[model samples]
Target chain A: MSPRSDTPSSPSIDESRRGLDLGSDRRFLAALILLGGTYVSLLLAMVAADLFYTTPGHLWHALGSPEIRYAIRLSLLSCTLTTLLSLWVAVPIGYLMARFEFPGRAFLDALLDIPIVLPPLVIGLSLLILFQTAPLRALETVFPVTYAVPSVILAQFMVACAFAVRTLRTTFAQINPRQEQVAMTLGCNRAQAFWRVVLPAARPGILTAATLAWARALGEFGPILVFSGATRMKTEVLPTTVFLELSVGRLEAAVAVSLLMMGSAVVALLLVRTWSGTGLAGVSSLRNG
Target chain B: MISLRHITIQAGSFNLRDLSMEIPTGSHTALMGRTGSGKTTLLEGICGLRSIRSGSIWIGDREVTNLPPGQRGIGLVPQDGALFDHLTVRQHLEFALEVRGWALERRETRSQELAEWLGLTSLMDRLPAGMSGGERQRVALGRALAFHPPVLCLDEPLSALDDQTRGEIVAVLTEIRNRTGITILHITHNRSEAERLADRILHLRDGRLES
Candidate 1:
């Protein structure tokens, strides 16, 4: 009888198993693609529906409205201001949170995140209540805060600043503390090291934080609705424009304004990527040494 | 001179108790230790980067026990250089001088001299990311030495380079020692390196020092 041929070469066994593994991998990948493709198709369908629902004529008419024009101008100005103010506050708070170990630091960290986790309308209500208090209420007589133009910016800032602070904190945390320590050893004082070494390293992160704040401020609705009251040509931002148009039963105009807001958001996100050449949220990526 | 008298440092649950050491001026001493022997902790304590629970640290006859890192007048080259990524080599060399409020002309002159001495004159405008391991290490050394502090501390500065680059850096280090009488506290685990560069060797095991 021939030598037992049941135990073939080990290489043939491995080759057959390898072929089976390849088939299994293909099936696994196919399942992943099928699941992921469904979500992507849903997103595409939503965008397609938004485009198909409104015409260029409606968009042009919405743009032609003097009230909408004024809303656009005010939205731009307030969002820019909110972004600048948010950065000014965020950088120092972020640095302290990232670098220091003080008493009640964990408590403070959690407390700072309240704006992020709180219900949107509650923030606006809280602001309204805050302005009604003694000192602010006294000041309100001289400088009106509640239900005013400043109230619009203030409401946007309440939510936008929390986002800016979170971004900046992560940015500062990613940077190596060694460079700051080395700077001190090389004759830089604490403040100088932060300004020269830490700040420069965090420049990309600052830009990202500012972009996030601007975007958040632009889309802010519930706070502005409750705090500033969406008066046409007074406190109407893009989101409020959509709300006001829908309230008047002009679905076409509401869709038009929503499309415009979407366009602006896309442009802003593109600009960030174009300017930094880093993908979204490249916080502390540029000078990570 | 660099002196540590009865120093006890507590890092987490590990304790380095009553460790004492002395290095004379213009001498190179190597510190040898196992992976977790607290060599870096002791080095940080000397440089004022970490707190020591007890005892005193003195540098060049002046007690720097409570001084801040910048006020200590000691230069430290941490592992792998720790060079600033955003700055060019020239900027790094003049960093200390610039921070101390030196005039533009003076800073330029000193940085130029240092660049030439470190064989990095051609690479002045390059950032740390664009350089070789040896070149970056040279820049690090030049940066630390630019301000001319009395003491220089090296924390495994040569361990990251290849064999030939290591040899080149060793030669450069030997020259640096001969030219300037700066006290150097070199940290290394390699016995051959310790024998080659250090005048005296000190070993650390379980946070205690042995000659």
Candidate 2:
């Protein structure tokens, strides 16, 4: 008898046994089918139509109205303000989380994430309560904050800031802190190092956060309605106009406003893509190097 | 002169304890050790990047123990030539000069001189990521040296290059030192490169200087 064989004779079987899972073809096929069936572009189109379509005549009338122009301007202005403010707040917070050792840092990080997970409506309600109640209410009386333009801004600021902080913290974490230290050793003081090295290096990531915050603020409805009461011409934004039109059964006006909102979202995305291309390319290369 | 007295640095688990050493002005010292030796830690301590738990450090007459890195007047070319990939070769040198408050005229002149000296005149406009390992290392060295630092620290400067490229860099480094007379603290695990460049050698193991 031949010596008892220990190794399999078929090289294909042995090679396949090394790195291949043998029984997941069906599951893999199922995943691909599910992915194809739930493709995102189709879903976006369906949701966009449902959210935006009302009556064509009202839609056209709303588009031509001067009030719509004011709404658009105010919406863009407020969202821009919210984005800039969010970035201003997020950078230091993100860098601290990335590069420092401190007390209660983990707790603070967890707390920052809470707003992102909570419904925007809930956050709005909570802010309203805090501003209306005692202690906080007393503080607010010294600085009033409910159902005003500032309230709308405040609500946008809160949610936008939360999104920015979370995104930026992750961005900063992905960078090596050694780069800043190296910059310092090259005779740059802390601020100089941050400006010259850290900020430039973190630009792409920061831009990403800003883009997200701005878009989120632009599309915000739940928070603004609850906090600022959706007053016409004072705190009414694009989303609120759509909401108002829908509630009043002005179907075409609602659709038109929705289309405008959708158009702006597209424009925002395009601007982000174009603006971040070169900066992110440089950053990604540096990261790889 | 760079001096460390009773320096100790604590990370999560490894502790570099009571490490005392000195690199005199205009003197080249090579730090040689096995893996895990505190050679890089000592360099960072000298540069004031890592905090010293218990020690006094002086770069020349300035007490740099607690000072920030920029105030220490030190330049470090880290391992694998950690050049900013987004910056061009000329920009790398200019950045150092700019940070040190060099005048515009002096910045241009110094960058030109360094680029020519490093054989980087042909590649000044190219970004670091597009450069070869040797080219990147050369740019990094130039960036560090452009500030005219009294002392320069290098960590495994030639370890990432091929044999031919390593030879070329060693030649350039030797020429740069001969002309500038800048003090060099070179850290490497390679005995051969250390022997080629070092005027004096410090053999360290587990954060302690070995005889």
Choose the strongest candidate by DockQ: 2
lDDT of 2 by residue, A62-171 (tens): 87887677788888888999999999999988877766767787799899988889999998999888887778778777776687777877899899898888877766
Colliding pairs, model 1: none
Off by over 4 Å in 1: A1-24, A271-289
Candidate 1 Cα deviation (angstroms), residue A257 = 2.0
**Residue-level lDDT tens digits of model 2 in B1-211:** 7888888986547788898887877777899998877787778778887777898998788787888887777778877566775578889988878977889999999999999999899998998766788888888888888888888888888887889999998998788778878888999999899899988899988768864
Lowest summed lDDT window (length 10), candidate 1 chain B: B77-86
DockQ of candidates 1 onward, in order? 0.41, 0.44
> How many pairs of residues collide in model 2?
3
Q: State the fraction of real interface contacts model 1 keeps.
A: 0.58
lDDT score for residue A61 of model 2:
79
**Proportion of native contacts present in model 2:** 0.55
